[model samples]
Target: MSKNSTLILEVKNLAKKFGDYVAVDGISFDIKESEILGFLGPNGAGKSTTINCILGLIKPEVGTIRIFGKDLFKKRSEIMQEVNYCSAESNLPWSLTVNECLRAYSALYAVKNASTKIDELLERFEIAEFKNKRMRNLSFGQRARASLCKALLNDPKLLLLDEPMASMDPDVVDRGIKLLLKIQKETGMSVLYTSHNMWEIEQVASKVVFVNHGKVMAQGTALELTRQEVQLEAKEPDLREVFIQLSRKAPEMEEK
Candidate 1:
């Protein structure tokens, strides 16, 4: 999507703290319709905290979150209807079968023809064969795929994915990314994707937001961030290197 695309999510000056420890400090970013924004940062950079704030799972002590141009805290129930999130950390009931878990979510979303939607998603993820398998019986990668299926059951306008492919094999990760891009293109859905795989981000994200020490350190296309780090000598921009360089800096450097 372009800059002209309707803004799907806007976060301004968000801050949250645990006593004297700041988990997220003055973080801000926006996601436009059909845009896949790569939310990049090292561990403890508050990327997850920022996402949690947007989901309204944790209220921020400062700032506002707007989804679809409405206050997230005020219209959260309404806004959540058009939003969904997926992460490796999100767990399904272990006793339930994969299909059972998906059915539960489809019902929650009030999806019409839930059976058909579940079937399609299972097929898309190549997990139809494991539909009846208990969630606990599935491998890490299989469970991740199942979580993804549940996330899309609502055909969400805004999807938040935090390391959704962290445990998947390379082949599955590739397939998952391709399917995600295809769906986003056809549905104009916006995605806030977080992953440590810089190559994967380069492949899918239309824009990049880099956070450090709970603040936005940079925001731009991957190429732009790469260029800011090093002069390109007729070579391709390397986002991984950019990540490395920024991640290695001392916390004091972020104040500059």
Candidate 2:
């Protein structure tokens, strides 16, 4: 990250609760412009809840969310114009053809030069062959590519991706990851990335936040956390081992 990098997204003391259970508890983090930040956690952790709050899909009972140096709630319309989100569970219209889906999403964002954007996205994702294919008919890997194409329609400044490579084969996953890195580098958009693949995280993320049971347990570069407490052979440390080490320990024992 640049020394004077601007913060594109800020979550301060964010909390979300459901009934008697706390889904997310007072977590705070920031994504710098032109940075990739990974959000990781074990199953049943508060990862999803925190993401929902950040996207404004669910209201947080406490804390504030700021995007582009403005309050998310008060400036939602303005903030959303340059912000876009995507998840592997993208429930796009199954009957719609790929082109139709992209067109509709572009209209929703009111993007100009719609046809040009659609073609560029399809070619970039290597999904132009399936432009006429229906969503329900496409394979999981193909659909994943289409889903990403839709997310890029608006040329967003901030992108939130939740398991963007889910259901993709090794080759497709590699392609998708590279495309994201390229977009960020060329456009300087901030990306908040979430996935279960530790190796993928190590490959793309510049910083990481590990949360469990609605609380953040650790925050640092992958190398920092992997080597800080665990002994290694001096070669690159595995992120999965670092995750296991952090999650398996008692909260009191893990570093704050």
Candidate 3:
């Protein structure tokens, strides 16, 4: 792929095995510029493992992950500079204030103009009031906001998010969704996000990849998936309905 091409991330025949069990079995996908691709799967469905391989946190025993047409493992450092990840459970240092945490992360990423970028993110997330508060002192919602700010500190071209709004209030969740859309619009960033909240995926995802048993079972626009499930007798085939239909087997109804 050409460097100027819109494809930012590519996973081809990516598979990982732990002792004889395959965690992710030969999955392939691509994320394009300015697209929000929802990675949906039930619990323990290899979603996290696939993401780890893409992030180079774990080496897949087979296949390749390419970012900007560069080999992911061989060019990890070069790729990491333009990519970042945030998870709901990932935490900053408890002893550090929010500002301190951001500063440390900025330095780690070798971000230029770190202070200015940190300030912009702080203001955008409206976390300036807690800038001096210790990480342990912040509420779950506040910490989620801080985590998002940290992820955005590098102005990354690719953002990997796992349950990005898991701890927020409904209002904050809405705000965060809006923020993500705005960021994608302004920066043309590509996002690969996983969330159990189907409604949020419906709202923000440009394309949805539904995974099951370590493979992609279905992928398309949310509307297309919903429409395709009309024959399944669902009253209204939304993402949740489509997800349940594809990921589970119906129990046999008892005879009258």
Top candidate by lDDT? 1
Highest TM-score among the candidates is held by which one?
1
TM-score of each: 0.96, 0.94, 0.91
Estimate the overall C-alpha local distance difference test score of candidate 1: 0.90
The number of clashing residue pairs in each candidate reads: 0, 0, 0
Across residues 170-244, which tens digit of lDDT does each residue of candidate 1 receive? 999999999999988888899999999987898889899988888888888888888886555526668898898
- Residue range 1-256, candidate 2, lDDT tens digits: 6465898999999988898788887899999888899898888778878888877889999999999999999988888889888888876899999999999989989999999999999999999999999999999888988988888899888888888887899887887788888887888888888999987898789999988777788888888777763654436756798788878865532232
- Whole-model Cα lDDT of every candidate shown, in order: 0.90, 0.86, 0.86
Worst 10 residues of 2 by lDDT: 247-256
lDDT per residue as tens, model 3, 202-253? 8788889888767777788787888775454434439988888877843232
Better of 1 and 2 by TM-score: 1
> What's the true lDDT of residue 78 in model 2?
85
Alpha-carbon shift of residue 195 in model 2 (angstroms): 0.7
Candidate 2 yields a Cα-based lDDT of 0.86
> How far out, in Å, is residue 102 in model 1?
0.8
